[model samples]
Target: MLKFPNNFLWGAAASAPQTEGHSLLNGKSATIWDKWFEMNPEKFNNNQGPSDTSNTYEMYHEDVLDMKKIGMNSYRTSISWARLLPDGKTLNSEAIKFYRSYFQDMLDNDIKPIINLFHFDMPWWLMEKGGWENRESVDDFAFYAKTAFEQFGDLVHDWTTFNEPMVHVECGYLYGFHYPAIVDMKKAVQVGYHTLMAHVMATKAFRDSKVKGKIGIILNVLPAYSRSESSEDLKAKAASDLLNTRSFLDPAVLGKIPEELVDLLSENELLPEVEPSDQQNIKENTVDFIGINYYQPRRVQAPTNPKVPAKMPEDLYEPYDWPDKKINPYRGWEIYPKALYDISIMMRDDYKNIPWYVSENGMGVADEERFMNDDGMINDQYRIDFIKEHLEQLHKGIEAGSNCFGYHMWTFNDCWSWLNGYRNRYGFYRVDLNNHFKRTVKKSGLWFRELVENNGF
Candidate 1:
């Protein structure tokens, strides 16, 4: 049987926006998701949106109890910005009370709380003020982070400034995957730079307050692989990695921008306006650790038309599909567990051997009910196998000198996703939308409990 390091944590991650229902209740202001759904109801699948979550707002106590019962040693969940500071400055009393109680429940259950301050849930008021594009939002976010630290720092120790800040730039600004969807490259750069600035500012707040726990950021770190050994393919892979991974990684860990990334942006005339002192701010406020949310590896080749002006990062590198690659059909993502090993190596060699953890990784399936057995429990053996395979790679990484201390699956309960809605389920507990959002432990969950109890399998 494979084993994990001593005192290693095993749990799941969720977010306030994805798991918390009562999106509009208790003085909670509207986030981009809420406003977007209000305007474009048809954009979401199954006509479901943020309010369709698993009711974690009301059910957080029970969820924490359930997590403890399942032998989860820790949990990662974001505190909704809109809910905490609805107007962006004032702390809503009721929202603060609910979050404090929710976090305390985890502590009482002997579960460590890894609190993330933001997770793609932009407050509507801030979005109206140009969101991250406006530098003022940087100050606004710093204030919000400081407030969170002041409020809950004693009860929670592990804090992350943001969850996948790059998605805010790519999906919302450069691509059309999310709300405020626009395809503007220049604005994407601006948004991205400002996001890094906000992160630094938040990190500064965490340090200035001398909070007791580590501060980090969750990045979707998909290692980019070349399709061929050709120079063009190699260059494509480099560009993809720089834009997608290092853009956030280098600054957060090394406290410096990758100079090559700067050159690429400059050559493409896609550079965002940078303040003269911004680098110093970033360089000084690097994170104590990193959170890797790896779902797949990226394979890229030379773009067919590089001569054309680069409007998007995708315009610079073409995606390549490897022959007979394992794929999660429901998510259409390449399933390459070996990438976890490579990523750990990358961290050890390239990023000062910075401490980190597997913050989010899971497979989502459709119609999970079809896997249910007669005992009313879902026999999700596929998910169990998925976790086993990924953990094997993670174990190899740890053995090979990666400073990975823990592993958190994508979520605890099946959450209400952004656009895909409730169609895809990724959770230890199967959430039956058809049955009053009933929660049942799948076979994977039972296996997970044993894994945690043994510290491995």
Candidate 2:
């Protein structure tokens, strides 16, 4: 039998834009997601938009009750910038009221709340003024973060400054998968820099405000592995890791970016100009903890045709799939439970093992009704196996002296994804969209209840 720590945080994670359905209610202005859906509905799977999500905004009381029912001691959710400050300058009283009630309800149910300030839902007004690419947006985000701390600092104790900031930079700026899609390497670099600066400013604000909680940032760390033992392949893996993982991890955790990456960016003239004060602020205000969101490992190989002064990820190394590796047929992500353990050990040995947790780790499946049993409950044994395998590896890491504190699943309920929308469901509760977003606990949900109740498998 595997065991977890006594104070383990058993919970599931959710974000505002993905779970909350009241996108336009009560002075809530448009987020980049809303505007993106309107501009190009075809980009989303099945034309599903944010307006008709799981309706968590209106049904949060019931949702919190469900969380309690599932034996969750903690719940991670985000406050919408667009909802809290609709015009980017004025605070929305209705949003304030809703969030306070939401947090209070979670607390009332004995569930600790972990609130994230930004989760890829930038307000449209901010995006209009160059979003994170503009240095001014850093100050704006700091103001927003301070406002959130002032309003809910007492109710929530665990605050995350940003959730997966790299996704916003890579997807929105370099890959064109998210809102304000632009495939410019310089813009992506700038956006990434400003995001780090914003996090620093927010951390300073949280520290100065004397908030009663810890503040950190959630990073999706995809460990890069070489396809072969060749030095070229190894170099390729290092470069990929520097670009995808260390680009955010080093600065957020160590208060400085990797010198190799900095030199590469400088050589290419893609480095964002860093102000002296920004450097001082970032160096002084590091996070209290780190949130590691591990999904899968990136398999890279020496590029067949590498470019000089590569501008983007694709230009530097070639991505390859390891032979005979298991894959998630539903979402096309590789299943490598060992990657979690590998990351834990890496952090322990190289990164000083700063206190951290598995912030977002789960499987997303499409057309999950096929997994439903005759009793009308989803027999999502696949999800159970996914969780169990990952947990086993996590337990091994813990026993090996990794400073992992908790594990929060990717989501609490079936919610909207950016491009996939509801096509991929990563929720313990099956949501019936046609039936007013009615939720039913799946078999894995029950299994998780037992795991949490017992503190392990």
Candidate 3:
């Protein structure tokens, strides 16, 4: 049996727009998701949009009860910018009341609430003004972050400045998978730089407020592995890692941009305009902890020809397929449990073993209902096995002196994904979208309850 530390926090995470159903209600304004759905409804699976999700806005009290029933000691969720500051400046009283009640309900149940200031849901008004590409967005986001701290800091202690900053930069600016999709390399680098600047400014605001808590940023850290021992393959892997991982990791933790990445961007004329004072703020207000959202490892190989300055980072390196790699058949993602251990050791050795946690880790299946057994229960043994293997690897890392203190799964209930909508389910509790959003705990949910109760498997 593997046991975790006594204070190990076991829980699940979800975002505001993903879970909350009342998207436009209670004085809330439309976010990018709402506008995107309006312009392109066909982009979402089954034509399901963000207007109605799991109805968390109305049923949060019951949801908190469900969390307690699952034996979760902590819960991580984000506050919607569109909900609180509908126009990005004015405060919505209803939104404030709702969040206070929602957070209080969690604390009342003895569950620590870990709040993230920003998820992917940006206000429509802000996106119209060039989003993060505009330098003024840094101050706008800083104001929002300061307001959130002033209002809710007394109720919560653990705060994340941004959830997966790299994801927004890649998907929105470079990959064209999210809202205001623009395939521009220069804009991607600019948005990423400004997002990092916003994080630094928010950290400074938190410090100035004297709020008694830890503030960090969540990064989706996927380690890149070379296809072979050849120098070219190793170089490809390093480039992939620098773009996907270190772009946000180095600035958030080390408080400085990696010189190699800066040189590459500068050579290509894609380096963002950085103010002199911005570096000082970042260097002085580095995060107290780091959040790692590891799902899979990236397998890469050297480009076949002389590299042209590509518009997308992935275009610079070639993706490699391992012959005998384990696969998540439904999701089409490689299932390498050992990657978690490798990442933990990399952090311990290279990142100075700063405190961190597995903020979001889980599998998403296309049709989870097919796994349901008799008694109307979804016997999701696959999810249980997935968690078991990953946790075992995490326990190994902890035993080796890694400073990982918690593990929060991807989500608590099935909710609206950005483009996939309800196609993939990554929740402990199965949400019946057809039946008033009724939630049923899957077999894996019970398994997780036992895991938390025992603090191990």
Candidate 4:
């Protein structure tokens, strides 16, 4: 039977904009989400914007009680930059007070606070000022990082700089899923470079502040697999790897960009506008750790539409419809439990066993409440099985000497997912969207409680 280490942390994660209610509380201005919801409410499902979510900002004390009940030792959350700095220049005292209380409450409950700096919720003021497209925003983010370290560094130990940098690039750049959406590869490359630069700068800030905790960047790691043993499929898989994984992994961990990316960017003339100082900063200030979020794997073949004109390799596989590939029916992600083990081994071998953690990993389902049967709880046995299977593979990776330290699910409570909204539930505890955000323990939640209590399943 596979087992976990005694010190292995078991808990859940949440972001501010997704969980915290967007209210004009005590002179707090609206963020990008609040502005976006106001402009087009219909864009969200059930016309539900960020207004009516979990309200975690206000209910954090009660939420910690729930965490204690569930046997969580570490609770991961992000401090919203918009909430912290509404004007992008000054620190909001009211926001700082709330966060202070929030951190104190977590520690009071014996829950280690794993705080993240930014979780895709940029301030509306910054968005208006050209967002990450402008180099000034990067400097602004670095300042915000320093401010956070100064304020909460003592309480919060594990500091994650950015949540899923690849997702940020995909949503904010190539795809128009996120704010200030620009569909240009050149702009995406610039955003990617600047984001890495921001991470490096933030790490420097945390170190210079003499913070007693670890600083890392969260990356969504999906091990790319070839569709078949064919050479074209293998080549396509390698290219897809560069596009998705290596693009961020190389810069963050190795303090260098992959040669393939450099060649591709040069060929397409989409290389980032890197200043002399930018290169020096990136090389000097690499992260101390990496937080890997694994869900599934990517299988690819050669590009059928070579004329599509996007140098990024994900575009290359847009044309071919590969058969005999497995996928998750409940959610669109492909299920490859083996990919979890492969990803862990890859991180250990490729990155020289850098200290890493499974920051976010879970299955999402539509209408999870239906899984409830004669009992008054959402039975979610499948959710339990999903996690158990992943953990078994993770244990195998650990046996192979991977430097994984902890495992935190995608969320703590049911919060609003970007684009998908609340339709997909990934939380251990089910949150009723209708019942004033009432939290109920699912079967999986109970199972996790015991898992955490015993230190393993």
**Candidates' lDDT values, in order?**
0.91, 0.89, 0.90, 0.81
Give the C-alpha lDDT of model 2.
0.89
Candidate 4 weakest ten by summed lDDT: 313-322
Quote the lDDT for 406 in model 1: 95
Ranking by lDDT: 1, 3, 2, 4
Query: What is the alpha-carbon lDDT for the whole of candidate 3?
Result: 0.90
Question: Best by lDDT, which number?
Answer: 1
> Which wins on lDDT, candidate 2 or candidate 4?
2
Error of 4 at 43 (Å): 1.4
TM-score of each: 0.99, 0.98, 0.98, 0.95
lDDT for residue 365 in candidate 4, whole number 0-100: 87
> After superposing candidate 3, which stretches have Cα over 4 Å from the reference?
none
Better of 1 and 4 by TM-score: 1
- Cα lDDT tens digits for candidate 1, 38-154: 999899998998886898887788788889878999999999899889898888999889989998998888899999988999999999999999999889999999999999999
For model 3, name the residue pairs that clash.
Answer: none
Candidate 4 Cα outliers beyond 4 Å, as residue runs: 308-315, 319-326
